[model samples]
Target chain A: MDKTQNNKAWFLVLPVLVIVAFSAVIPLMTVVNYSVNDTFGENEFFWNGLGWFEDMIASDRMHSALGRQVLFSAIILAIEVPLGIFIALHMPKKGFWASFCLVLMALPLLIPFNVVGTIWQIFGRVDIGLLGHGLASIGVDYNYTNDALDAWITIIVMDVWHWTSLVALLCYAGLQSIPQAYYQAARIDQASRWSVFRFIELPKMSGVLLIAVLLRFMDSFMIYTEPFVVTGGGPGNSTTFLSIDLVKMAVGQFDLGPAAAFSIMYFLVILLVSWVFYTVMTTLDNAETK
Target chain B: MMRARSSAIVMTVYLLFLLIPIYWLINMSLKTNTEITSTFTLIPATLTFANYVTILTDPSWYMGYVNSLIYVVLNTLISITVALPAAYAFSRYSFMGDKHLFFWLLTNRMSPPAVFALPFFQLYSSVGLFDTHIAVALAHCLFNVPLAVWILEGFMRGVPKEIDETAYIDGYGFGRFFVRIFMPLIASGIGVAAFFCFMFSWVELLLSRTLTSVYAKSIASTMTRTVSASGMDWGVLAAAGVLTIIPGALVIYFVRNYIAKGFALGRV
Candidate 1:
């Protein structure tokens, strides 16, 4: 649809602009202000120039947190995308069971982040928790609180349990949109199940798959509350990701200049990914409209 | 028939994996702390509603839910009310910097709540809105409004421009036409946007926790108090966690009918 030129249309947009500016722009500017300046108690300040950014860039702690964050995100994508696709393929196509599956699967997603953390924290406890107690009983040594590998695994599994449904749900919707005619054509050809999934479903799901990947990646990158509640960044900072580290610096230690500098860099990374997401989504929207 | 059976088996195993942890949570919520620590039972040996009783009877505990609901509802209302017009503008009209505006709006959605937490504390504090329900509601608008706009725009774009032209030729003014005609057409879109808004606001802990303290402390914050009081109060903690899941569960249940449809058309 061709849109008319309308300068007056800004009126419709102005409310969003004002609300976002107050909430987004102003706080963002504050972060910038802190990133470039030094401050002491009673709001004393001095010019810091690029010093904080320079420090954060060279900081090994920052590098390690970023490394862990990237690896976590990679692992999440690796597990969730395939698992979600598999689950979607096996899901009941239509009927009471489909509705039942959808409702049950969506339950974890709606729960608050901290509650999710709490659930896992209790569920993974060595003394009382089912997973930990069961593992112990089986002679499999595991303690999420003390072991770094266990902590990592626990967080990863917790994330998978919390979020895989989102991926499956998106792909299910994509699958639903495929006409029965396509399946009938495949049947006439006697296409093997693998071939049907590969040729028909895979290509069809590409659009929503990208959407699933982007959402999962962006969200997994920003994970904080769940991990925080579970491990409190762990036995020895073993589970501390970027957000956890930033919160420790900014709020826990009150290192405003460095934390703010770290935030800018952190945001820049998400912004870059989100820009790609925006471009792809806009292109998809345009294709549909045309 | 064999293939369908295998698929059913696969989904059954997967669903079991999902439900066990939740079941474990419910099981813990129903057991006493002594039972939780002393024994590992698949089912609670002695079912008790003591934890639920403790939370429901405690003002501090139950008010956390109330505070969360108030702000979530407020934020959703504000986000949708503002986003509706903005979405209409972006979906239907070509204007100066509209593309730039849209992209900028999305950046906020992607912005980490951790990044905004400190500055929002300062901003809200300076305005003297600190620790108030309204502050959390306004602070949450940072992400929710942008998301609402994006979702609403997607739904609005599907509405043909012919509807507008027909309404205009019928001598309906823009306001009446928009309110009476355009809105009804995109009502599902509005519902979808509102649902997304509510979900994000409800799940978010960082911003809401930061923007409010006592008098308006959210359930998530209130839950944290259990961690600090002497030893862990496992039963009440589990109960609070279970209660927190209730509202979200109820919300999802109500929207269960439209959830798939909502997601198919909604943006992240």
Candidate 2:
């Protein structure tokens, strides 16, 4: 896989670079510009320096949103990874059943994020929705619109339902790549099922597992639409994560300066975490190959 | 035998849990609004296609679907076309800043769409591309191009360098070899990349909604407006939601096997 030295490769990458730069760099610069300047109506501006950053640092609102976001992502990763792995392990490896399982499991993933939110929103309603009415009929009180705990549970479950299939599919693919000779060797050694999983399967699946973790972490952290539709970050600001809060500040209220600063910091955190994941994964890949 | 039986039972339960909500949505879509609200029936008391009729017959409703498809298709085509060469470069030759460039592309993929929402709104409007299909398609490239490169690079790397050498020995130029030989070899990779691009573009709302208002309004945003306006038409909303799932379902059906292979190999 070692590549040759060819500076002309730059030409190959130019088209992507131009498109991404237009889409990413220009807007990013605007955010930076807004972060440093205060503006009133008619696009009139004043120097704000680090005022917005200072205010963001001192604000409890941003802190709470960050806290909620971290907790949500952690919970999602903890649940989805193991549950998805379990589902993948149990899945039929070949034939019609495998295709059937894949198609059905992948359905949630293909649905629009807002539709997912709407489905859960109605499904969890007390009067008309099935889950809500069923819970009430069974003498269990549940209302996502009112109770913070119920709202949190519903969002978590909704996320799990929507995304667990992705993890399962990735792991299933990882499992499929293992050669049959490996299993034959384990059988010849009379290896226990646990040992077989521990020795043969886990290491083989690590590459895909890392990819799954990274993807799930990034996506869950940036989640906006589904939760926005379902809870509107509501029942009190309890469900308002970083993205929701940022949108409220930037678009809803037009606090451009603070929102810009907040966004820079938010983007940095994701970048740092993703960089760390990327480094670790690449290191593992290199080590495995060596 | 016992273990296999338990595995089957567990999978059955898991599948049911996955399916019930989708089933509920479909059930609601088939029922009239009155039936949907008044009764707790597992099956529709009386099936009605009025909701579907409403969507199909209305320009505002059905155009949302058309708008989404146009941009998604455009974005996928542009992303893959641009990414193929970039991916080839990364796979075959390590140029100056190659590693840094690769990582930087990924950082864009990691960048939160919310951060860029306001700036993109202004940027597009200033250029007079706002509310246009091309604007959304271009804006989505920030993420999709990097991803397409990442996925395509993985597939390209899997193809031995010897092919390029052999093609050269056969006096085939880079363009000819790429189109005639390399493309067919990595066709599945392209399919997988296109599928991922389409999925992300299809599901994304905030940016697409922010960037386009009328001429290129997406179905997701249209659904949101429906929920907010006056009395909520639960039946129609459910029906709209059901329709939104159709395109993605069709895509998944076609690429079921490639999807898993793509994920496992493509650094997704």
Candidate 3:
């Protein structure tokens, strides 16, 4: 199917670039501009020359938020990836039941982040919320507002409930795409179920799982809405991820110069890590295809 | 056989863990504030629809739903319209600076929404678009359009080149073929993309909250003011949260199959 004529499909792409540039690129440039300069309001601006960047990098507030962000992303990947794989493994391969399970697994994901936070906040209430009240009745002193450990548990549990389904769904797709002949061959070799999964399924799931991990990492690193709603970055900033802190700087304090610099640094961290994930995953994809 | 039984147990436990919070939310919505605050009940001691009734009868609360719905729909429409052409271009053509452009679009998706909350408020207020649904809708498009383009482009590539050739040989122009044949075949993918655009825009709080103090406030934004003279209205908050789940739940239930595939498309 050699093409002798140019279709001039460039027409299709121009609208996208234009819209995205207006919506994204312009705002980003504004943020970049703010990061290096000081403004006193009413369109007055002065060059500050990396002063905000230096302040942002050295600030303990920034350091703590970065630490929390990294830890949270690591925890999310650790829990969701394996748990999703386990659930995917157990899911009925083909039947009415399989479809039913798939739909059931997907329900949590459909709920919005803020709503998820609200639900947990209510559900974890000691007086009215079920989990908190139940825990108290059962002799567990669980108060998310007062206890740092409880706060961590609540957010971590909330995230796992919301996102593990995504990983499961992705891995399920990878599993579904596997040819049945491989299973039959494994059976012929008398491979154990554990061996079959370890040797065959794991490798087959690498591509989609890479995607799952990357998406989860990126999202977890930038988590704001749910945790913000749940704790309001409370219990002494223990649960304040990088995003929430950035919001506090930009919106709460109206420190545009510092916040903008923080945001750029934040964006760069996500970009750098995502780029690494993409490179490693694509290389593996290439090797697998070859 | 033993392994199968254990796996079933594990899956059941996992499902229960995932659902219990949502269940509690629904249960609390059915209870009165008195019952909610005074005692811990596994099931509501007495069920009431007062919370739902409050949200519905009150024009202000229900207005949040209307506002969120309008902007989300608008955002979805605008994103899909822009992304369809863009995604097709990326998928079909090796244009100048395609890789760089694609990455640039992705950077939009990756940037934190919180970072833009203040600027968006200032920018929109200066332009007199503040407190309008259009403002929130347009702000959402910043990220939503990039996401829609990436996902749609992935699904579009899976469509065979043979279809394009057939349309071309039949003397069907690119526009006609795209509308008549290509769109229908990728209906599921488009549905998936539209659903995502709707979901993101629907749940988004920061910009929606900052940009609209009154008119375009989303239900998520409304949840912020759930505290009243009577203290935080757990019953009302729970009720609002449950209501917020309905739109996305209904949409996902209908497109359950596509949701899985669409996620794979977006991420990859």
Candidate 4:
């Protein structure tokens, strides 16, 4: 759709601009101010230049948290993407069962992050919770509070429970968009089941798959509340992802300069990665059109 | 036949896996604390609504839900009111920096809430809006507005431009056309946008919790801070959790049809 030139359209957009300036821009400026300056009590401040950034860049804490964050995001994508596709593939194509499956699968995505944390917290308790009690009765000796591996598994599983529906739902929508004629053509050609998935469904799903992966990556990278409530980033900083670390630094310890520097860097990394996904998505769109 | 059977089995297993934890939460919510801690009954030995009773009767507890609803409603109304015109502008006209503005708006959606927590805290506090429902609503606009714009733009694009021209030729003014003619055409889009706004605002806790301490505390925060002298109040906590899930579940039921379309950012 070709849009006509209309500078007057800015009037229509002015309201959004005002709200955004207050909501996003002003607060962002504050973050930048805190990053370069040192603050003392009574609103005293001094120029520290790029010293905080240098310190944060050299810090082992940031490195480990980044490492853990990367690993966590990688693990989440690995498990959820494939599993979501599998679930979407098997979902009934339409009618009663399809609606039932969709409504149920979407349940987790709608729950509050903290409630999601609390659900798993209660569900994984060893005393009376079914999962923990069931496992203990079976003699698996599982405890998320005391063990690193258990905490990791619990967070990962909780995330999968909380979010895989999103990917599945997106893929399901993508699958729904495929014309029936394509599938009938494949059947007429006597295509193998694997070929049907690879040559037909896979190509169709690529657009949404990238979206699923990007959303999953961004959300997983910024994850804080669920894991915070479940493990409080504990069993000794084992589940402490980037957001957890930043919150602890800025709010918990009041290390404003470092936290501010960290925030800028954190925002940049997400921006950079998102830019990559955006570029790739546009390239694909262009190729598709061509 | 074999493939059909296999798919059914796989779906059954996966569905069970997705549902069991929720089932467990439900199961715990119906039991007494004594039974919750001491007994291992799959079914509640004696069903109880005492936990739900506790949350409903307690002012401190239920107010959290009210505060959450207030801000969420405010955020949705504000997001849609502003996003409608902006979405229309972007979809219908090419203005200077329109593409850059759209891209910039989206970048905010991807910006981590963790990054803005403290600055938002300061920004709200300085303006004397801290601990107020409006504070959180405005703060949430950072992400929700972009999404509403993106989703609404997609919906608006699907409506042909000839409608606008037809309305103009009929002597319908811009305001009248937009309100009476254009809005009804995209009423479903508005619902979808409002639903997304409500969802993101409701589910978000970091900025909401940070901005409000007591006067306008969120239910999720109330649930998190739920500690009795004895220790964790598992029964009441689970009930609060269940209550939070109910609103979302109801909303999902209403929007089940548009949900996939909305998730695709209004693309069909």
Top model number, lDDT: 2
Q: How does chain B of model 4 score on TM-score?
A: 0.97
Residues A49-135, candidate 1: write the lDDT tens digits: 999999999999999999999999999999999999999999999889998999899989998999899899888998988998889
Instruction: Encode model 3's per-residue lDDT on B129-222: one tens digit a residue.
Output: 9999999999998889989998898788778778988999999998899999999988988999998898888777778888888877787778
lDDT of 4 by residue, A129-181 (tens): 77887899899989999999999999999999999988988888889999999
Candidate 4 C-alpha error for residue B9, in Å: 1.7
Query: What are the per-model numbers of colliding residue pairs?
Result: 0, 0, 0, 0
Candidate 1 A-chain TM-score: 0.97
DockQ of each: 0.74, 0.79, 0.59, 0.79
TM-score of each candidate's B chain against the true B chain: 0.96, 0.98, 0.96, 0.97
Q: Please, what is the whole-model Cα lDDT of each candidate in the order they appear?
A: 0.90, 0.93, 0.84, 0.91
Please say which candidate is ahead in lDDT: 1 or 2.
2
Clashing pairs in 3: none
DockQ score for model 4: 0.79
DockQ of 1: 0.74
Q: After superposition, how far is residue B200 of candidate 4 from its true place, in Å?
A: 1.1
Top candidate, metric TM-score: 2
Worst 10 residues of 4 chain B by lDDT: B224-233
Q: Using Cα atoms with residue i matched to residue i, what is each candidate's TM-score against the true structure?
A: 0.98, 0.99, 0.95, 0.97
Candidates 2 and 3 compared: the better one by lDDT is 2
* Candidate 3 stretches greater than 4 Å from native: A1-7, A281-290, B228-230, B266-268
Q: Order of all candidates by lDDT, from best down to worst?
A: 2, 4, 1, 3
lDDT, candidate 4, B1-268, per-residue tens: 9988999998899889888988888888999999888878888999999999999999999999999999999999999999999999999999999977887888888999999999999988898999999999999999999999988998998899999999999999999999999999998889889999999999998999899999999997887777524487788888899899998999988888878877777764
Tens digits of per-residue lDDT for model 2, A173-278: 9999899999999999999999999999888889999999999999999999999999999989999999999999999999999999999999999999988998
